[model samples]
Target chain A: MILHGYFRSSAAWRVRIALGLKGLTARQVSRHLRKGEQAAPDHLALNPQGLVPTLEVAGQGALTQSLAVLEWLDETQPGPRLLPADAWGRARVRALAQIIACDIHPIQNLRVLQYLKREMGQEQPAIDAWARHWIATGLAAFEARLAEPAAGRFCHGDVPGMADLCLVPQLGNARRFGCDLSPYPRILAVEAACRALPAFMAAAPEAQPDAE
Target chain B: MILHGYFRSSAAWRVRIALGLKGLTARQVSRHLRKGEQAAPDHLALNPQGLVPTLEVAGQGALTQSLAVLEWLDETQPGPRLLPADAWGRARVRALAQIIACDIHPIQNLRVLQYLKREMGQEQPAIDAWARHWIATGLAAFEARLAEPAAGRFCHGDVPGMADLCLVPQLGNARRFGCDLSPYPRILAVEAACRALPAFMAAAPEAQPDAE
Candidate 1:
């Protein structure tokens, strides 16, 4: 397996954690997002969206989209399953994950920030504020969800599952953008529990091969 | 089943199509997004994010997030399955869906546009441009993905699956924003195919009880 990714991409970080949890190693192919290497014709051919963490499985072709790739890994590989066993539990975990992946991360990603700066002519402070706002809002909701009975040591249960996978990377981005974390104790606790595992520890952006 | 949703919400529209495809009907509980009804205390208790469509199943509690709800409906209900049977094919379909749901739609949703206009002090034309930009960019990638051998009359095969559920709604938004659709012939063709289905037609926002 070959994983085409950038060091600091939260989406790629999610995939890395899944691989570690699955005890599977993929050859790393770094795409320097800042240098726009992901948009290179070859990479674009692999993923039409030209995003990172495109997993080239042995024979299954390339899987793009972090959640899709993560779910695919969970389905095909034998390891700690990322989702719950039942339908309702799966829905809960997926909703938690998508709250970050869909509602939060997409609005504050690098490209959107760049658009705000370049196209909208927003200053750095405004851009940072925009990022922080979405992160804080989303995390508050996540924290509330975690306060529910379904949440255990992790986002779903005693085991770190899909929601934890998403929460850890998002908190990474939140910390990077200097967002206040005081309000989200549940999310912070889940992050701490997830980081205690080798999978989450190994997948941190600073631990990646391409990290500056 | 009762669905708390805004008529024009692309995410909610996806679930409506899935419900129709599954031959299930839900009582319509409209949340006027522009009026901030989704953020009401009662709705927030049901969905922490205060977004729609939140499906209130008979025994399962309120399910949030469109993709999560769509998948849950697919899992628990009897219908023409929205996902492909194979893991690889499922991954492909999901990746296509997320390319819109995760990458495109969230960034251009009503809240984000409101942020751009009110907080950022951008004008309507600029906000419209931002919407068109993300839609066009995402649709171009979607079109390319459809060009792959795995793609048939629909995003995966001849069946109108999850990807098509996402595509048709997004194209509707694109057209509403006055985005030029000429570049994505494959996407348009797929939209036409999907709209041909009674499920998709019935799920159209205009057909909803709260469309006004």
Candidate 2:
């Protein structure tokens, strides 16, 4: 299998961590999202979404969406389970993941930022503010969720699970946008815990082949 | 199971249809979002995110996030799978749902609209324009995905699956924002097909007890 990805993309970074957690390796295929490489005919053919982190599984075919790709990796590979065994615990973990994946990350992605600048003709200050605004708002809710007793060293339990895979990448994006992280103390603590793991550190965007 | 929801929330509506499709009935608890009911202390205790459609199962406490709740409903209730069995097919279907659930919905949610009014002091007209802009961009990509031959009458092969559940609620939202639907012929067609289904029709906001 080959993983087509860009270093800066949180979505791609997510899949990388999941693969590492499972002790599985895939050949890396760098796609420069910043340079419009994703929109090229070849890449578009693989993923009509024109997004990075499309997994080219040898016989199974390609998988898109970081959460989906991660779920696939967890189910297909044997290692530390990314999710809890019980249904209720699984629901909590998935809900935590979606809080970041669905609620926080999407609104502040690069594409939306570009649209704000180009299509809406918003100035840089406005765009930056826009990014921070959504991040701050979403993170506030994330922090509240983590305040629960269910949150241990990580978002859910002691060991890093599915939610950790998502939180790290999104926090990276948050820092890149210079959003204030002070409001989310629990989130910061969780990020620190996740980063200590070799798998998460190995999957860092800076550790990727496409890192600038 | 019991569902804490509002009549007009798309996220809540998605869970409503999922529950109906799975052949389970949950006691419907209404939280009128526009009236700040979701923000009340009682509601926040159930869902820290202050989002509607937090599912309270007879045995399973409270499950927040529509996607998570839907998955739990699938696992517990027998008949009619919400997701595909195979990993690759599952990934494809999930990515389609995220395209709307993550990419489209968050930016146009009620909280974001309130932020535009209170934070940036943007006028109603500009705020409405912002909502329309994000929805059109997302729906365009949604339409592109639907054009793939894998798509049948619905988002995937014929039956209204998870993606279709997401799509229908979002289309209801898009229409509420008064978006121009002409550009998205395929999306409209799929939604039309979805509306024809009894499950989708029964889950409409206006069909709910608290819809006023």
Candidate 3:
């Protein structure tokens, strides 16, 4: 498999964590998102959305969307399960993941930030504030969910699963945007547990081959 | 089961369509988004994010996030599968869905629009243009994906699955924002296929009791 990704993309980071957790190796091809390489014709053929990380499988075609790729890995690959075996537990884990993937990340991603500056004539500080605002909002909700009985060493129960994969990357974005993380102690605790794992360690943005 | 949702919320409409497709029924409770009822304490207790389409199951508590709720219903409910049995197909369908769910919808949802107006002090025309820009961008990608060999009558195969559920409602948003649909013939064809079904018809925003 060849994973088309960027070093600092939270979505790509989620896929990297999933690959490590599944004990699967994929050749990396960096699409420098800041340079708009993802929008190039060849990359667009693989992923119409022009987004990182598109997982190009050997027999199967390219798989776009980080969550979908994560699910595909957990389903087909032999490794630690990224989701729970139970139905409701799977739902809870997925919902937690979506809080980051759907609600938080997309609204404040690089493209949107670019739009704010170039299209809307917003200054850098306001754009940063915009990023911080959405991240803070989503994380507060995520923190509240972590306080639920279902949450344990990870986002769901004692095992780190799909939600943890999403949360750790999102927290990286939050910290980068200078969003205060003190309000999310439960999230911090989960992050601490996840960071202790070799899989999580190997998948950090700074550890990536393309990291600056 | 009880669904706490607003009439015109595209996310809620996705859940409604899923329920209809699965031949299941959930009692509807309107949380008027325009009135800020979603952020009320009662709704927030059910969904920490205070978002609509909170599916309150009998014993399993509330399920948040439209995609998660749809997955849960597909996993547990006795109906036509919302996802394909094969891992690759599932991933493709899911990736298509996430093109809207993650990349498109959240970027231009009601709250985000409110923030553009109230917080960022953007004029309505600019906000409308912003919404149209994203809708057009995402739909173009979606259209490109549909042109692939894998796409049949619906997003993945001959059946309307998760991606179709996401697509139809997102089209509603696109039209509302005056996005040019002519650019996406494939998307429009799929939407037509989905709309022809009684399930999709019943789940339309205007078909709901809470629709103004």
Please give, for residues B61-124, the per-residue lDDT of candidate 2 as tens digits. Answer: 7899998888787777797998877766677788889888888899899987887677657789
lDDT of 3 by residue, A9-108 (tens): 9999999998898888899999999999999999998998899999999877899999999999999999899999999999999999999999999999
TM-score of each: 0.99, 0.93, 0.99
Chain A TM-scores of each predicted structure, in the order given, are 0.99, 0.97, 0.99
Q: In every candidate, what fraction of the native interface contacts is reproduced? A: 0.87, 0.72, 0.92
Model 1 chain B: weakest 10-residue lDDT segment is: B53-62
| Candidate 1 structure quality by residue, lDDT tens digits, A64-144 | 999999889999899889999999999999999999999999999999999999999999999999999999889989999
lDDT of each: 0.93, 0.86, 0.94
Task: For residues B1-212, write the lDDT of model 3, one tens digit per residue.
Answer: 99999989999999999999999999999999999999999999999999998999997799999999999999999999999999999999999889999999999999999998998899999999999999999998999989888899999989999999999999999989988899888998999999999999999999999988
Clashing pairs in 2: none
Clashing pairs in 1: none
Decide which is better by lDDT, 1 or 3: 3
For model 3, how big is the CA root-mean-square deviation?
Answer: 0.7
Colliding residue pairs in candidate 3: none
lDDT of 1 at B163: 94
* Candidate 2: residue B117 Cα off by (Å): 3.9
